[model samples]
Target chain A: MIQDIMTVAETAKLIEAGNVLLLAGDEAVLRQLPKGNWIGGTIPYFISHAEGGLATRDRIFVTDVTGVAQSVEIVERDANGLAKVYAEGPQEGFSVVIIPALSKAHLSFALNAPNYKDFGVRPLIGWISGVHLDDLGKVTPKVFNGVTGNALEEGAVVLQATLKPGKVAEVGIVNLFEQGGGDILTFPADGFSAKEVLVNGEKRNFAAYIVKNKLDTRLPLVADYYGALVNISFQGIDEVEGEVKFYAPVFTGIRYKHAKPVADYGEAFKACLENKCQLSEDRVVFSCNCILNYLYSGLEGKKTDPFVGPITFGEIAYQLLNQTLVYLEVHDV
Target chain B: MDVPSMSRPQWTDLVTGKKTYQLKFLAAKILLGRLVHSVKENPTPANIKSCIEQVYNVYAKNAGSPSVQEDLTTIFG
Candidate 1:
């Protein structure tokens, strides 16, 4: 039996091999509503009789509901008039998973993702996004790339894109409840032992799929974990003077799931604020700093909140909104 | 370390900076582990294998401790 999850290197290989791909959707048009993707079809939509905080069984009545506005009409039609049932949105709305304003290369990559066309070359990276329910459900964080020709701070602009099929999912692709949302890219780790290692559930290969043909355009998105977080930070920059640093409440990735699902950024933010997140005290680590710094070197402004050696109150509050930082450990700066 | 030969520049890179890619990578891995372990009850065999592979590949390449080294080999080797 298989026990441990694949390491990043191994995960990289699997991703390369195309055994799995980040789940994704075909293209569809939008109608200007804040939309949410729904599971393909298993879960049925019903009217939420009461209003307030969302209950387990409540359905956001399409328009007035608190969830992302995913019209069941979010789908594609065959020449025969049969709808594909994947979550789709009107032209004006957007999704964090497949946003175009950030990176066209990212979106294009997503379009042909897992394009197992060339089986003999390198396995293609596949993406699967079943993230239908937004954690905040209402307020979707806008994806901001650094505005060009402006200082990093000045051009910290939230962006929007011209989207296509890959940008939208058919209304009823998969059941979010049965699917249990959140993107995961599984990799190798030392979480397994000799005896019962093969069945280590936690070690399974779960990864986020952010590579939706993501680079065809000039968007600044990247294919790493800190996805939008890093993009926002590196929004505007033009070299360096002092130093760039971001101090925020960072949670241990070890217990991040316990806090909140990535699909729901608000509750995760809530969990971090409630002190439910923790700082990781152990384990070997790696920083995709190369990836991050690469972005910073190209940005127009310094997005660092304050490098006063420790996190500032404002920084903490900002992190509270993004929920990216979990622990408040201040590095000796 | 299990691997082999390193120059002086390697040592400087490892300890000279407060936020070297090396340190951050380790920090990220640890963070990922802590976060994942806390919730992975029976992280699937595939998940376990993936985790083990990540741990060992990094260890083999980076060369950390004896216990972790031993554990990694048992799973991947």
Candidate 2:
């Protein structure tokens, strides 16, 4: 896998060379690339091979898929058009999608992806595009369609890549946090923000409940989706409004518990990878970790070896996830 | 376990937590989660069948695999 940070000139060369690529960089840098077979999302933060976690706008992180992909098709879809995302993807291949942060497409995908037609039938993996933390409200995040050289802020740009014969793509996640032995939390409806929640079967103000328990907001609410431990990270709480906002929507009928505290995020993440993930480093085509992990764990210059890519706003395995590391690997059968 | 011999009520029991069966596969778990939520609201035959068809759609690519076939039989039969 050709995954690394390169200068804009070098990235443009790869694009011109017709290599199927998934590029991540500053919006300005990505806008400088030539048109070709690729899709790009704006983000300055990344966990690079040379430097573990660093933010740079001058270079782009490129994942060259020319070797693994037999053919690649780029599609741009709005919130409603995203309904066809999985249904339209190559039957035998995987998709890489990039939706701008805070866009309608992002909200729609996070809240309704589970109900999408053929949802989870095929491997769909990607990240939510975001600007520099400093530029959060100043500049909107954008995704680029290399085919048309168009950047979009309201929809998603997807790369539907058909893999080589006998090769299969698999998406997996590494979540360091587990459900703690805390009160069972349930919400009344599916949404990203909530004012009320059921705590151990009792109705309570969601924000007040968190404040009363002195919960560490950095840790996400973990739920067991079958064997998969899904995470919904905390975005913020409005004390005046008595509302708690989450990076991903919390669904009704799902039981959630505050995640157990981690003594050291860097060490725990590395250990989880070594123990839980049996990955062939070379076979890993792409991987990305949540930006929340980067901020909370102070990942600057710290390496989560064997897995590295963009430090994104949110991650997507089959659906939107938060405070987790998601990766895609190809295996020959 | 002769899962195919189980009745709709038994399957509902498993999903609704009246019974238990360890599901294998993320897709199965996800589909079952949706089914459980839907059945709780309205367990009409049409709704149950629709949810069952979704589970089958996800496993359509693996329809030939013995484990997938068994799971389909266990959940839908």
Candidate 3:
């Protein structure tokens, strides 16, 4: 029934099937509207039922965000030739985008071209959040879309689309060739890292060096599990006790910290406390796995550098963060 | 409410309007990318340098991230 909604269109096959079209809006609007065959496939109706009925009662509402009337439509044809317009709209806000078929196969492409990743992937969820319904009165497969916001501009490339765990799948910015596919970029991290770690005979406090230079705002680690908590927790995994190689942050020599020899994690902590260790803007980065290995095994046997030995997810995170102020300047995106 | 005076701003700061929150998110992800790439790739001084800079630049694009207001408050406060 044509109600308070700004616009709506029903399927044409139903009308072509010769079913008498009778519709009512809410309980008290009191007028059963006329139903007719599709024009170019769209069942176009004006917004009168919404004039006084529940429409004015604030049932279904659609607000314009870009400060313009957004177009809504029910397209019957997938391609251009059959391009049947089942419905069209400037639908009222707070309304349900009701669909005819509630199936996993139900599909609709957005014309807005939104990018959620740009808004931190949080605000973008609004585009994909809605109830999908079908003629059989059953809920279809829920789809969840993880779109990289940058590619979701007015006419950018669509990146990803898919179904989610629940019956509420959503897809956003179907394109993203410009953002990642173009240039280099940078950002910040909470920097979950240990400031100081004690190997066998040496102790280095990367944290104090960072704090000394007022760069510790993002650093978040005290005595981490690597150099200090190793002896007690891990025992057999002592593969990284020899020739440890640290991947220090070059920082263009901005903040530099001196690497030293200490007794253990305790000594590293004590040295930091006693010296009021200052964060060095010039810094280097190393893996805690190596320190953890040394802490557990000590210098009993020859050790090798894992930085050159193996790779893990954590190592990747560290390297990328080290050069966060980077760029590859591809202007095309 | 009267509309605020600062309606329009430049693009540089506008892109990173939420720099603080965005950086952290990108930082973690960059690190992941680095780890994955380092497998067959040998990380040396020149190599590490470019990798560091590349990852940094890539992640910096996520302008509006969590805790960014706090970071900006610290930087400009």
Candidate 4:
């Protein structure tokens, strides 16, 4: 797996050599690459081999999938067309997707992907493309269909790759936060922003509740989807409007609790990865950790060894996830 | 923990929240999650049957796993 940052010329050389690549970099640098078998999204931040967490616009982070993929196909889909994503994917392989942040496709996928046809039936992993923090309002995040060299700001760019026979792809997530011993919270509806919540079956103003309890907004609300511990990170609390915004949607019937506080984010990640993931580094072909984790955990100079890729705005294991590390492993049957 | 053997009625009961059991596979979890939501909204026999058929088809596709195949037989038989 060639997961490393390279100069524009180096990346173009790989693309020109027929490498099937997943790329992340600045829009300008990604635009400079030669059209080939690749899919890219704009993000200047990455966790590179040489640097623990680096932000650079001049280089591109590349994951060469040519070694494991027998054949690769790239497709672009808008919000309404994303329902066929899983059904259209290869039966024996996995799909990697990149949707620009704040795009209609991103919001649609985040809220409705679980209801999509054949959801979670196959391995699907990817991240949400984003601009640098400084460029949040000034620029839009974009995805590239490398074959056409078209940069799209509205839809998703998907790379569906069929694995070689005997090689199977599996998706897994590592989340450091778990349900804390607090009031069980449920929302009035499914949405990214909530003005009302049920606290222990009692109605309460969502933002007011957080403010009254002096809750730490950095810690997300955690829900157990079956056995998987999923997170909904807090984006912000609107005091005057009495609304609480989240990075991911909170469903109506789901039970969620504030995450247990972590004394040390870096050590917590290291220990969680050590205990939960005994992954052989080589088997992990692709992976991405959330940018919130990178920022909150102070990972700028720290290494989360054995896992490296773009530090993204959001993550996808099968559905949109927040504050989680999603990885795809190729195993021999 | 042993895999709980469930009959079709028991499966419906579980989906309708009459009983609860920890699902052992991702396929079961994903299918049951949607079914549970569906039956909660409308507990009609046709709706429940449609959910069951969907589950059977998805489980059949993943019958490559011995455990899934075993569960399928245990539930449908």
lDDT of 2 by residue, A1-333 (tens): 689999999999998888999999999999999999999999999998789899999999999999999999999999999988878888778899999999999999999999888887777899999999999799999999999999999999999999988877777788899999999999999999999999999999999998988999999999887657899999899989999999999999888999999889988987887787777898899999999999999998999888889999999988899999998888775
Per prediction, the TM-score for chain B is 0.37, 0.55, 0.36, 0.66
Maximum-TM-score candidate: 2
Question: In angstroms, how far off is A198's CA in candidate 1?
Answer: 29
Native contacts recovered, each model: 0.04, 0.41, 0.02, 0.12
Best by lDDT: 2
Q: Each predicted complex: what DockQ?
A: 0.04, 0.39, 0.06, 0.29
TM for every model, in the order presented, reads 0.19, 0.92, 0.19, 0.91
Per-residue lDDT tens digits for candidate 3, residues A1-333, read 111233223322333343222221121121111233111101111122123111121122221111111221212222121111111111121111111111211112221011101211211111111121121133221211111111111111111111111211111110000111111111121112233334222454433433343432211111111111101111111123322122222211011222222334334433543463222211111111122222222422222211111111011111211101111100111
Best first by lDDT, ranked:
2, 4, 1, 3
User: B1-77 in candidate 4: lDDT tens per residue?
Assistant: 23333344766775776755555445466457657777888899888777766665555544444445455555444
Ranking the candidates on TM-score from highest down gives 2, 4, 3, 1
Task: Name the better of 3 and 4 by DockQ.
Answer: 4
In model 4, the runs with Cα more than 4 Å from the true position are: B1-34, B37-47, B54-59, B62-77
- List iRMS for all predictions: 16.2, 2.6, 12.9, 2.8
lDDT of candidate 4 over A154-182, digit per residue (tens):
99999999988888777778889999999
Off by over 4 Å in 2: B1-24, B62-77
lDDT of 4 at A239: 98
Cα RMSD for candidates in order: 23.5, 3.2, 23.4, 3.2
